[model samples]
Target: MFTREWLRAVVVVMFTLAPMSVGAEVPWQFADNTRYMAMGDSLVAGYGAIPATQGYAYLLYKEGVFDKIPNTLLSNVGLIGATSQDVLDKQVPLAIDPFVPTVITLTVGGNDLASILTGADPATVLGNFQANLTNIFFQLRTALPEAKIYVSNLYDIPEIPMATEIVLLFNGIVEGVASGFQVPVADVFSAFEGRKGLRLIQRNGADQYEVHPSNAGHRAIAKAFKAVIENN
Candidate 1:
C-alpha cells in the first residue's frame, strides 16, 4: 500500500497544495461591498513604488488582503500635491459614492505647514491649519455618514535638519486633531522619523525625500495602516 513511487507522488501533491491551503485558512476581517475612499496628499498617491502606481490603497485592494468580512470597494482621491485646504476643496467631494458602510482614509497638512513656516507669523498659521483639518474631517463626516473614517497623522519630514522642528509641530497638531475625531490614525510620523533626510528613490529612480517616501517607506506605512484597520 506504501510503494516508493506512490509516496513520492503524495509528497509532490502535498507541496503543490500547501500554499493554497494556508492562504484559504487565513482569516481576513474588514467590511465587504462597502465603498473605500483614500483621501490624502502624495503619500496616499504612492509617490515611490515599482511602476510607480501601486499605492497602499491599490496594493491592499489588488492583493485581496482585506477581503474577508467585507469586500473592498476602493476609490483613490488622493492628489499628487494637495494641501489641507486643497483637500478640503477638492478631495473631499470625490468621496461621494453609493457604497454603504464606506471606509475613508486621509493624509494632509504638510504643505500648509511649509507655507506657514516661510511666512512671518507661525502661531496663527498653526491654528489655522488645525482648524482647517478639523473642518475637513467634519465635512467628510457630513458627506459620508455611512462610512468609517480613518486618517493618517502627518509623516515626520524634518530629519533633514532644515524643517525638523516645524515638521514635529505639524505632526503634533495632526495627531491631536485625529484623536479628537475618534478615528483610526496611522502613525507614519514615528515610522518615518528615523528615515528622514535619507535619500529614497522614486519609481523612476529619482532621488526625492522632501515630500515622498521610498518603496520601503510605503510598505512600512501600509503595514501600520493594515494593523490599525484590523483592530478597528
Candidate 2:
C-alpha cells in the first residue's frame, strides 16, 4: 500500500498546499504599483508574529484583501513604541518623501491612552491625542493628496485600567479626524471585541497581556480592512 509513487504524490500535494513565502512575487513587482503604507505602532509592525509578514499588512497584500488595489508594494512604518505624536512627527514625512503612498492604514492613539497607565490623567491625555491625530491627518492630507487613508479605532482590553472610557473617547476622536480627512474607518475595535485573549493579543505575565496582535489576530485585522475595501 506504500508505493514510492504514492508517497511522492503526497509530498507534492503537501508542498502545493503550503503557505506562500514572504518574498514571493505578486503581479511581478512593478515600480508603478500602488504604494501601500502601514503607519502607527507595534500592531502595524507585526510585533508578535513569528515572521514579520505573518502580520496584517503583508497578509492583506498576499491574500489579495485589497482587490481594489492591484500591483502594490507594502511599506510598513510601524514603530514598536510609537505614540500619536511620534506618528505625527516621525511617520508623516516617511510617507511623504520619495514615495507617495496610494493607500494607507493607521493605528495610533491607543498608546496615548495607554500612557494613562504611566500616570497621565485621561482628560489631558485625550486632549493631546486629539490634537496629535488632527495634526497627523492634516499633514497626511496636505502631503499625499490622493491617498486613501483608513484608520482603525481603539479596542477595549479588560486588563487595562479605564480602557472602556478611553476606547469611547479615543475611538470618537479617531473617527472624527478620519471623517475630516474623508478617510474610512476600519472597525478593528469591534472585530477584536471578545477575542483578545483567545487569538488576538499576546499573553504577558499573570494578569497582564501585551496589547499587540497575535498572528491569528493580525489575520482578523486584515479581514476587517478587507471588508472595508469590499464594502466601498
Candidate 3:
C-alpha cells in the first residue's frame, strides 16, 4: 500500500545505502597511525624527477595514499644506484630494526640488470637478482609479518639493447617472488609499457639515455601503486 512517492524515496535510500555497504567491504582501511616505509633503488629515490620529492614514493606520502599526512609516518630508505643486493643487505636491516614499517613499497632490480651493460653475464645477473629479491621478501615478511608490502616491477626501456626481453624476465621474477610472500605488486611495467615521455632517457636530444623516470613517469607509477593498494 505504499504510495509512488514513498517507493521512489525508498529506492533512492537503497541505492545510497548500497554504495556504503560495498565501500565497507574493502579489505584495507586507513589507520590513524600508518608507518609507511619506501625501500628500493633510484626510482624509489626519485632520481629523474626534477626534485626528488616528485618521485612516486614521495607523491604517495604527500597525497596521503596510505593515510592522512598528519597520521601517516614515512621512512624512505631508497638509495640511488641501489641494486637488489643492496636492498637485501643495507635496507632490510634498517627496516627490521628501527623503522619496523607497517607498510612498505619496494622498487629494485633495475640496477641489478644494469650490471649486464658492464660486461656482466645476463644469466649471472638475473640469477643474483632473483636470489636477492627472494631474500628481501623473506626477511621483510619474517620481520614484519603484518606489514603491507608492495613491490613494483621494472618498466621497459625499449631503446636499450635487449631491454625488453630482460625486463620481461625481471618482472616474471618479481611476480614469482612476491607471490610467495603474499605481497601485492604494482604493475609499473604495464603502466609504462606503451607510454611515451615517461622515461628521462626518452627525452628529445637528451645527452644521455638515462633509465630514470621523468615526472610524468613518477605520477604514472604512483597511480599504479595506488590502484593496487586500494584494491588489494
Q: Rank the candidates by lDDT, best first.
A: 3, 2, 1
Q: Deviation in angstroms for 226 in model 3? A: 0.5
List model 2 lDDT by residue over 28-126, tens digit each.
243465667788888887776779768787687667565323445556677788899888877787778644678888888767877788889989998
Go through the candidates in order and give each one's C-alpha lDDT: 0.63, 0.72, 0.82
Q: Write the per-residue lDDT of candidate 3 for residues 1-232, one digit (tens) a residue.
A: 2233443353243234222433443212333368788999889888899888899998998888988665565767788889888888888887787657799999998888888888899989999999998899899988889899999998899998889998998899999989988989999999998889999888887645488899999999999999999998
Candidate 2 positional error at 134, Å: 0.9
TM-score for each model: 0.73, 0.80, 0.85
C-alpha-based local distance difference test score of model 3: 0.82
Best by lDDT: 3
Q: Write candidate 1's Cα lDDT for 55-158 as tens digits.
A: 67656555555553224445555667677878776666555422233777777776666675456466777788898889987877777766778777756554
Give candidate 1's TM-score.
Answer: 0.73
